[model samples]
Target chain A: MRENAKDPERHARRMAAKQKIMQSRIDHARKEQGVLLVLTGPGKGKSSSGFGMLARALGHGMKVGVVQFIKGKFSTGEEAFFRDLPGVDYHVMGEGYTWDTQDRQRDVAAAEAAWEVASRMLADDRYQLVLLDELNIALRHDYLDLDRVLDDLQARPAMQHVVATGRRAPQQLIELADTVTEMKVVKHAFKDQGVKAQKGIEL
Target chain B: MRENAKDPERHARRMAAKQKIMQSRIDHARKEQGVLLVLTGPGKGKSSSGFGMLARALGHGMKVGVVQFIKGKFSTGEEAFFRDLPGVDYHVMGEGYTWDTQDRQRDVAAAEAAWEVASRMLADDRYQLVLLDELNIALRHDYLDLDRVLDDLQARPAMQHVVATGRRAPQQLIELADTVTEMKVVKHAFKDQGVKAQKGIEL
Candidate 1:
């Protein structure tokens, strides 16, 4: 043990205090309802984190609906795996990245189509979890109407969770979200070390 | 079509310019090597994000090693499902949360034991990806020597990817990592809405 380590009795007392505080907090947090989670920022893993929740939802046998708003240029490992799973309604609606598609009109059309799918899923009580992958990008580019999206999200079932992921999330969405996580980029191998996206890791 | 949409020819020209820039940047990024990823901050889904990477690694037929540093209190749905899959070596190595254990010495011992397992996997070439879950917490409480942990991580195989997940990651670890994502808390349902941790979502 380190020489400066706390005595066992002292540690016990400290932990007891912590336990009491945590227990009280846990007890106080008794409310149960669905949550709207938004993952946004200039870092990696926004969609990946959303997929993690998808996996968790699937593990619990919950019905999930996934609508890819802006990612379809390259095939992702997640789409390959989760699409085959039971209780998952997966739809890849976008043609590709905005720049790759090379057409603002086409991008708007795709975003609208994706939003239609997402709105239907949000309205359906049978789907416990709905993931709108890269919806933020579409919103960022003004490819979809922000007001309509917010109104639809507000009208979702009380017990249905919704997760929207991508960079540059709208401030309105952030304000309405029950939980919002911004993935800050501390370091990125792609930018700093000239590292290409790996098969399993990045794709 | 939206009445004010950009002309198709103009949109195509703009996209062509973007594609050229993107292609040049993509062409410049030619390095291939394993990445050290750190997921840290005061928000949810740090571990969930790590699990997503684990799933991605598995989908590519990569061998994965998981050493849970401080999350053995409850049986997680992820553990129950992923443990059954082939090519995954999963070890749950903590009595429970630090407050739950209430024993500093015991917690330190458990963390050290878990580190030993992590070190071995880091050295082994068979495991392509290794996830050290809640390791930042152990390091945060000074239960483990950060220097030794850094040295071991530095000594790992060149092609092995390691992911560390937890809040308050040491600055030294962040400096060493290839990809670092800080999950900033915009809002938490537990703190703001009195929502308790759900079974599949929080377990």
Candidate 2:
């Protein structure tokens, strides 16, 4: 069957069968609601993809909120571009990187404060999309209670979407998320080629 | 070692040591050049991240080009948002999804035309960043010549960056890329939960 796929007639027949199944699947999916997305693992673009969704939400004229949990020491390109955009409420609440701060108490305090802002957005239906940048790091460190976080997410407005991004997402979060993508590193310029991070690329 | 992270003083000492090594690496990385990034795998966010980088490039006031390969049948939110934006030269050249078209000759022709546009952008220094969206699909289907594509990429402007996105990226492209990320699907809304594609999120 695989070898015969090159034949035009056979290919068309196979595709027709596939089209039928796909059409039925599309017809069956009638539920309309907000989705919870988790972008995690030890590769790049988790935050970038979150920001992309932020851009898409803005394109659709939807109100959105962003809360950064663990990268406040230095400003980023996304922050510079999106901070002042209309319909976007952005906040960077992290004290700094954990190693740079070197204080668990401060990190915990920062995570708590950021979660407060996130929870408010989750409660408000006006915020159609909320991006919790690096929130997984805070969860991994136990700075915030995972159960409380899960509860808040589950209890958010029915039409409000959320995107949580970071590395090493917890099992509970993955299970709860409607969509989850784990980015795996194949090669890294900085690590493999000793190239420095570029402004538009990595910053 | 991980257990002792709770001790503030010990944590500080460990961080200090790590910082020294990090600083040395930072200092050692002196060479600078444009990077080629490949985002691939069977999960979502590859094109989203490519568009995210496109946004990042635009934020910096750099000129960019985008050529979408397999997603031209229907207009996308990104295209609607980015097509008229300043400094963006966007083009969608795919005939349609392979199954939808089911014509190998037409699909190959479309791929060929898309590659022409992409190659032009690669050669032009004015396009600081060029996004070859879903080019890997063309390569995978043998609609476009991989060796020619690689040659064009290698011969691009010295300071030009390129991002190619799609699933099942060839190993040669991965080997040549400065950074490669493979998005692994832990779960999917459309697949696992039978949820339709949402406008702001999936589209």
Candidate 3:
């Protein structure tokens, strides 16, 4: 026996309803709201991943602000690549990593300076992503305060993505995070073969 | 013009030598071997990027492993996406987040258990890339020994790539890194809009 086929108009109506629901779900699934991403682990390529995201966002014409907290010195490949890119706003630790700062006050001052740029970016709703590089360690090291950071982060005007990468994110900070990621060390190349870090590959 | 045509091989030799020199400098730039990548910071896509790398590596027919430290008991879209993929070894936090554990001893014990699997992967050269998700915070919280982790990473069998994502990477770890990235938060949607974290986007 042949089953009766539905009318074309009814079939189209049903399909349209299904498509609408699917589209709605897709839209909801997208992280259109600003997100906090914490990248913690003792591994390589955390910042590389952040740079890669920055590049992709910039490619799409999204404005980006990068505030490196602990690391300032050494010419990074990311800095060299995106310093002049139209949508990129980059700030490095011109003095280098915190340990080399030689003065805690100087380290704190540098962090504050970087945060000034970062804070402005956060306030400006134009940026799609703001990278607070190594900020967690900065806080852990007392370069910045948790209350002030949380307050400022809360005060940002609109939907803006933020990335904080470091190893010792405070409990309060993690609690506040929308998304937390921990990178584990399973195995690495340098350990196995004594290979030194490569510039483009590592930096 | 005729003389230039005769110099093609000479030009190739010079180019090769330049590449070699660049490689050597990159290999020798750092006093330490292996690159420590701490993927810490506040952002939404750290794990996404790491898993993206895993997908690319697997696409290239390389083996990969994912050991999630504190993210079990929660539904993750990434887990759904990669769990069934070939050439991937999956490990989720058997226990939930540390706060939920409420016992320092137990949290340390869980970290140890996860480390067992992660450390094994770090030692094995089978996987081209191993993602140690959330291991940074564990170390920061003193759930694991820095030296022990470094020792395992140093002794890894194959020249493997490792990605560690978290927040607040320690100074010692930063000093040990070939590349360090900080994902700074300049703006965020949650603080401004009070939007609840939706599934797939934040979870």
Candidate 4:
């Protein structure tokens, strides 16, 4: 493939122009700090993406924390795999889906309890990466105080990263996040193809 | 929190109605097969989500194949962690970004070479999950035949799942996919806050 690098001069010229622009941008980006990442919307993989980060953080031997909300109805592959890992502090505090639970007071208590665990992770600098899995769901239903939640996130350790995932994230959280990704649904297997959730994929 | 389940009678009534509807939907969804998931858009986590699925599949002890395209210039945290795993076949087959490589002919050859490897995995049922990372970039640039790619995917083993990740996914690929997620960026650290990519997070 290296032999196929014909028109070397033309390629060099083009690359030089692009390199200058890219280098300037890189030069300007000098800040380094923790990031508040909000992963929200109707598509799949919001939680999956967060877990991906967890895996990466673990690869680097970083201490991590996981607090899962609104998803304790069944055992998940992620929880099963990550819970016993050496540097992980994993907690699944949800009672279940809102419709299944169907009790606002109970849901509120669960969210509050989950928040306590999450807040502890935020305050501690030892946890380099903390995944607040589906925390936005609790916030969406007003089970957790949005103001307090935002305050804790903002006041977290300077080098501590947080990833919050769920659907229909609060607008205020979006504004506060350093990186926000809204996963839009183009198609879904369960809804469009009559496919049930399967192990090692949706679970 | 269970003690906070006040208005038990009303809660039970609501739960029964919701359960009936959910059960009916579950009953109707009888198909069982692998999923074709496409993760695309400008937001982050497209590749991360694919890798997350990779971790979940590994947790279940499934044989997995990973082919990275247009991202072999520098090693990534995922490549480092997953490449040496027991049941994984990891291949980094790209010559780098198109701008850096700066040769359409060479890029086409590299993409073709990658497709050959991907097609082999698609044909084998022993590989339960295949992650074609950044394949959309090649497809988007017309380096590979879109129809041929789609045909190969459709003809893959019935129980073999595949995840394709990148930005600006073609419409035809989205239409053929069982699940498609378009990640919309509300904010980005590099763009909005001038923050450089960090280890174990964006790398």
Candidate 5:
């Protein structure tokens, strides 16, 4: 271990080689455009991850629009903080989760209304980042037409980054996305420890 | 569809039932203590999700401590934004990723040093949230002793929430964690689209 630690020359050579490879890759990846990201799966942090991007966009002084598709039943901490921030257009349009509503037709109407708002934001060039929170849930429940959603997404402004987050993303949306993350459930507190969602951490 | 939309009374009844159930569950979840969360697997957003929690902690006026275990080589937007914030103790104690470093002894040494900083923060009661970014990568490579890391985590203050982010979390750590998320890579831009990590999004 001591001998390995002392070999600074070899480490320097190795790093140089890596730097060359990375630089070439970086150079090759020169295309710059807004990306569509999908966060899905049965694990936690899908929405939380979307919010992180929202925060990042805010940090960059970019205009952000958020349309919550199925999470307006309970107030979240992110809403309380980012809603009041300047250059943010935040809207919570859902009545609640689908299971809580239990009315398919009503849920469909609510989702359509939410998508109307989302479509407008996607069309508007002023917004650099548009977060369609829980849109996958709406799509999964067949509350929103997949074809119409795809068409709207395709027609969005060239520089507008869109992030759709929820569990069980549709195959077509995944195919259309530049980045798709599936948050697999390794272990959940609700399932394993019987710990319900809390304010600071889970809300 | 019109008839379903007009049935407000039925919707109200269902919502009321859900409200009652949710409220009871919320009441039942009265136990409040610090949560240890592990965000792992092979996808993006592990660190991003941890940052979201950091933001939540900040919103609650809680002190935050961040130790970047394997991301010190480059300047991330999160570090640029949060490092200067009041009540945030930010430390980037890595020589980049292990693959980049390519020196096991040096990587082990760096991991130990980073863990030292993490251990101090975990022991301090002043920090309500401590984020150990990319610590799982270090653990996966066996750069730091798992038993020691678990011991330090176990000794943290009762109300100090800890979040460790990276891929391939150890099974023992998962067993001990209150919440664990595995971010599966459905589609990565680097792999599929050849999109490099962007400034505001990936960094």
Candidate 6:
């Protein structure tokens, strides 16, 4: 029995009011609203988590779109896993990582193309979820328009969730996000030793 | 300025939509309803992310509970930072990592105690989020009861969100999770050379 908060009856009512929440089924539960989320920080797994959410949304028979910015050349497990799914659309920016890119012009062009696809998904209400993988990196590098990205996310139709994953998400984006998750690195086996990234685990 | 599902929309409306989405919030997020989430796989940062979420909940005036299953004796930067945070109840299973804890009995006892705290949080909505840090490792090593854990999780209060983090989460837990995130390590900086886990970055 909870004795700390309100009256006993009120507490009881609060306790009993547990059946109303629907998890992972937010769109179905509300059918009136959606979320704009940012998964950022210096830690790894931001993109992985966003992609996981994308997979979950797709599994629910919902259409999903993915636009990977600042990442075009390398193949990710996510791409291999989700690209084949039905009703799923994907666009990978071919400029690759910043360190890997030789031409800034090419990188900017690739980022714009990726943003174009992501923008389309943002406006479309039919796609239940849109994953802007590494969009923050594009923004951080000044390849994409920060105000434009923010504006598009805000104007996105209801009943659709947009996930932006990358490190150093803009402060403005953080301020605008309904939910902002920062992945912090703590204990890593790689740093402990010489454990390298392996297949089926990393890319 | 709208696009059809089968047809691409005008680029400008799509851009406008992003603007709007940026301004709005993710209302009634899965967390508001208390979603059960599991962070698993070989990559690091699983427990770290869960802890970060725990901190976020605490910062928002939400009660939080943390049970570090396989993390003991190893003092982490996160523990130090959040140890003094308000509304955060922290408990670390002092059994250290599983590899170091060769004693099965001790490991089981540690896990059982951690589960005691976790299960209680699962039933109590006051603790909006309860994190079982490195729980999968304990579960994988058979230190914790899989069936009991799942049953308790299913019976948890709808307003309670339980996050289990670590490598190799049990099949049943993954199947039951409203959100299951598998952290994949792709080209980490530590592995590039022999850079050790720097304090404040990776403990």
How would the candidate models be sorted by lDDT, starting from the highest? 4, 1, 2, 5, 6, 3
Candidate 3 per-residue lDDT over residues A1-203, each given as its tens digit: 01112243443455466557644654555445677767666655456456545644553456888887755333354455556668778787545554344455565678778777888888899887887777877787666667888888878865787878777777777777666655554344444444565433442
What digit string (tens of lDDT, one per residue) describes model 4 on residues A1-203?
12224566676677678778776876887888889999999998898899888888887778999999967433377777788889999999868876777777787899999999999999999999999999988887777889999999999998889999999989999999999999999999978889976775862
Worst lDDT 10-window in candidate 3 chain A: A1-10
DockQ of predictions, in order shown = 0.54, 0.51, 0.05, 0.45, 0.36, 0.03
With candidate 3 superimposed using the best TM-score fit, by how many Å does residue B19's alpha carbon deviate from the native?
Answer: 30
lDDT of each: 0.83, 0.83, 0.63, 0.84, 0.80, 0.63
Model 4 lDDT, full chain set: 0.84
What does candidate 3's lDDT look like per residue over B103-126, in tens digits? 555666888888999888887778
- Select the stronger candidate by lDDT from 1 and 2: 1
Which residue runs of candidate 2 sit more than 4 Å off their true CA positions? A1-6, A72-75, B1-6, B72-75
TM-score of predicted chain A against the true chain A, for each candidate? 0.93, 0.90, 0.80, 0.90, 0.92, 0.81
Candidate 4 CAPRI-style tier: acceptable
Q: Total clashes, candidate 1?
A: 0
| TM-score, second chain, candidate 3 | 0.78
Stretches off by above 4 angstroms in model 5 are A1-20, A72-75, A101-106, B1-31, B72-75, B98-110
Report the C-alpha lDDT of model 5 over A1-203, residue by residue, as the tens digit: 22324566676677678778877777777666678999999888888788878877777778999999977433366676678778889898767776576766777888899999999998899998999999998887677889999999999998788999989899999999988998887776655665756556672
lDDT of 2 by residue, B1-203 (tens): 12343687776777677668777876776657788999999987888888888887777778999999987433376777788888999999858787777777787799999999999999899998999989988888778888899999999987788999999998889888989999999898887777876665772
Clashing pairs in 1: none
Task: Estimate the TM-score of every prediction.
Answer: 0.93, 0.92, 0.49, 0.90, 0.85, 0.50
RMSD of 3: 18.1
Model 1: per-residue Cα lDDT over A1-203, one tens digit each: 34225687777777788889988877898877788999998877788788878877777778999998867433366677678778999999758987788777788899999999999999999999999989988898788999999999999998889999899999999999989999999899988888876775862
Worst 10 residues of 6 chain B by lDDT: B1-10
Best by lDDT: 4
The per-residue C-alpha lDDT of model 6 at residue A145 equals 79
**Candidate with more favorable, higher DockQ: 1 or 3:** 1
